[model samples]
Target: MEFFEKLKALSYRARLTIVLHTVFTLAETIGGVFFNLYLWRLTSSLALIAQYQFFFWLAMMLGFILIGYAFKNKGMSQLFRIGFWLNFIFFCLIVWLGERSINWTVYLGLLSGLAAGFYWSAHEVMVLSGTSDKTREMFYGVLMSGESVARIAGPALSAGLIWLGAKWRGEALFGYYLLFAFVALLFLVTELAINRVKDVSFERFSLRGVFGLYQRKAWRWNLWRSFVDGLMISRWFVWGVLSYLILTSEVWLGTMMSLVGVLAIISNILIGQWFKPNLRARLNSWGAALLVIAGIAYPLLLNPLGLVFDQILGEIIGIPLFTFAWLAWFYLAVETDYDGKKRQFEYYAGHEIWQGIGRILSIGLFWLLASNLEQVNLARWWFGGLSLLFIVQWWLLKKVRTALVKAGYKEE
Candidate 1:
């Protein structure tokens, strides 16, 4: 009853944004579930997968940099619309190219990445603007729940549709192209919904001012943390790929993803309700440590089922606990720099540069290692190595937290 009351109190802008997010997110998930699989079917090259992903993050980082300048004159709504249309165009190209898309992986990846980078960057700002402190919690809760449900439902339905369609249409590629068209066409709904949102103005900071944000000590430290965060959240490191390879079945892949999605939803619910400031250090530490454990343990199994177990620990337990706790730390540490207002968007832009670099490096490193190392050892070495950075982040948080407290900063 209380949650419903809060939900009812949301502004129209918030409502429309929620609708846009739900539809866009659903289409993205449906299209994404099989996109790589389609590529894999065409070429079966991990190196190509890594190359496609490398360019995606490369363009995404560039998109962030360019959008920062664009925001000087353009509204977030306009940028979002551009991203929305670019994504629509991306899917349209995939449908049109069909088998030929395999040759254009790098270009397609760049287009999609730019679309994602701009859309997410602008959309996040819109979310912050659309709701006040009183209603923000409920707004995010509803948005997250919708996203979670889409993750659960989209792949399940798409997998079934493709399997059935293979028999009816007599070609697997036809099912994929059909799904791409559906996703591309679905954007019309989001386009209408987002246009309904009135543009709200934020204080514009000069590009010089935005770039100068890096001079501050607190934010400088946060960039390092966010870089590791990006490495952890790499551009093309979807776990289901390994699962699909091992299981050799789309249905199995969807089932594993849905089960993991259910567990993630449950974990997020529990974490959101139970998280506390005093417990931040402990939870984040546990989460980081668990990720390392999962990474190291996963490759040992060498079975398709290992993917499910790895996701259970990594996504459900490790990711949520660490992510929530680290986010709490960011609010306390990073967002508190020098009045923290008049430059919120600038802070976001500066952070994106390093984070995007980190993502690009992640795939770049994988490609290099794939050249020399055993493919089987990739997860162990990659996850183990990256998890070390989490520990570094954990220490940085402690140092920054104490220093901020001494400097008279407090979590809002």
Candidate 2:
């Protein structure tokens, strides 16, 4: 009750952004869980999924660079709407592709990545402009909570729809098509809503200048943090593990994902209300440590029981803590002065590039390793590797706190 009231006290722009993100999250969750399943059903190759994601990250990196330039020259809303429409097209293309050929999955990944880069870049800018430093954490918490709620509903609904389609048309693909269509409609609505937001413009920045920020100690750490963050959150780790579980057991995909969502919702509420600014470092450290533990435990529990235990721990503890830390640090990075509004795009662009590089490395590595190993051995080795990677983030969080302190911020 108190938390909702606090969220309500935020500025109108912040509230609007929350609403927009909630819609976007709902649309994403509906088809996102099933996308890999669709590909897996069509082609039972992990390599194919890896290649698809590889290209997706590659395209996203390029899109971030290009779209950042566009945001500087044009208005933010234009790029955002373009992203929305592109995503709608991406889904439409998938519907058209429909098991006819698995080869097109690569192209779809590229298209989805491009759409993501534009949409997320614009969305972050909106979040930056909409909330002040005082209200940023509150806004982020509310946005996350809203996303958790959407996630809970979306996966469960998607599962039911898939079941219905299987019963009615005798093909689960039909349900995927329906879900994709709904996602398209949601994007259209989102596009229309963007028109209501105030328009803001920025002066153009040189690509050279943006890339050159890596020389500074703070910027370098920020970039590295983006990479580490990217590695932690990549699909290869989260979805890859989950997909393996579905393949091995009779676990209901929608129900399991929805259960995770339910836990995530509870964590979001606790974090939003109690995770104060001063406690950022402490909470982040704890989160990082827990993630490391989960990583270690996952490979040890390579069987069904281990997988279930890892999944439960990750949802209830690992995700919320790490997410809170990352969001807090990111908000600080964006809010830190880099000259003026003119250069904000460059900062974000640089951040995206670093993040993309990290994702590419993580996914590309997985593709390489998994390609060589027997499918039976892939999950175990992958989980081990992923657990070790969490240590990098733990180290990076400390560096971020140090950097923030040096920048005259009170506390991380």
Candidate 3:
């Protein structure tokens, strides 16, 4: 309908790039989840899973560190081109490891992380460059919608593939590995096509030169914001919770994850077309409100259901219940007001910092308390704390939103 027309009018290059990158993201999701599951099956240890996660984050952190600097000095498309090849190589390497029967779950996880690090930092940098403040929110929402769609399909398809692989190859792990290899090839081909796009730049790089971007106050602030935001939700909290949940229940986890992905897709559509275009501030406020509600309800409701069902509910709707709201707010924030060349880089750096902090805090405090306390006691404690956390996070978001609004970041 009119929605497609509006999207087409936004920017042809932006739409094409988003669609192309979405294809890559879809493959990565499918390959990534299955690879992690394959490793889990091989090790059958939560500790191993945790180790895998640790290396994954470490690799990603390193990638971001390097790319953050490069993004400051070099061009966006240049970064994109480099990221594609790096990711493609690592994907092939992972497949090679699988072929050798080197089922070192920890190393495999690290490898995946390393590959992803290059792909993500570059991808974000490039995509963010394609839009400006007036359209950035809608742009991010659309981009995320593509990712959400991929996530929805990835887990469901993975589960089915796992089942089929076991039946056909007589070894489920082998089947998973085969699927991963295929996806990697798909990535390689896509990257090749993307690079061939006329006018895509491939500029030179230098670590020392990137520091010049910091001289611009706008860019500096953007980086700070991104780092803080990234820290809050980055690999830390998500990975820790995921590892814990996987140890508790894998099958249910995959199913519920896909369900969440489906919800995210719906949310993305609403965000991109309706919320982003019309009510940026309202979306921010609503997202905070949802968090406030869910934070209180989750622990209270989950305990009685027992761990497995509780996990399913949490995965499917409980965790994401507040997250979508938070994300809606952040995407809008990024899309507005900030005028800078290396916006995503700066924002991501700051976001990564906060994400790291949040992860550390959650892992240290939330995980500790959740792990040690009696289930009933923990449930009671978390119910109250979750509510409090939601309120506090909402307050913080409100402050940020207010500040941004004061700075004149309103919808057109």
Local distance difference test, each candidate: 0.69, 0.72, 0.54
Model 1 — TM-score against the truth?
Answer: 0.88
Q: Give the CA lDDT, 0 to 100, for residue 148 in model 3.
A: 73
Instruction: Give Cα distance to truth, residue 143, candidate 3, Å.
Output: 2.3
lDDT (tens digit, per residue) of candidate 1 on 1-412: 6556666788877787777677777777776658877876787655667777888878887787677666754577777688888989999999999899989989999999899887777765666567653344355556655666777877776677677668788977777777778778777556655663477544654568666866766666777777866786532354545666677887777776777767666666556455555666688789888877776566666476566667888777887767665555454443455555446667676677778777777888787877676654674456556656767777766665665667676444
Q: Estimate each model's TM-score.
A: 0.88, 0.92, 0.71
lDDT of 2 by residue, 34-69 (tens): 676677667766676777788888888899788765
Off by over 4 Å in 1: 1-19, 130-142, 205-207, 233-238, 331-335, 371-380
- When sorted by lDDT, best at the front, the candidate numbers are 2, 1, 3
**Per-residue error (Å), model 3, residue 321:** 9.4
Instruction: Give the Å error, residue 177, model 1.
Output: 1.5
lDDT, model 2: 0.72
Q: lDDT per residue, candidate 3, 1-412, as tens digits? A: 8567666666755776687668867777766555555554665333444455556656666666666655555545555556566666656776677634334645665566666666666555555555555565566567777777877777666666666777888977755766666676776777666643433322333333334444434334434444444333322233323443434543455565577677766666665666443454465555555544544454454432433444333433334433444444454455553443325455554455445444444334543454455433443454435445544555555555655566565645
lDDT of 3 at 120: 65
Give the Å shift of residue 324 in candidate 1: 1.9
Error of 3 at 93 (Å): 4.0
RMSD, model 1, all Cα superposed?
3.0
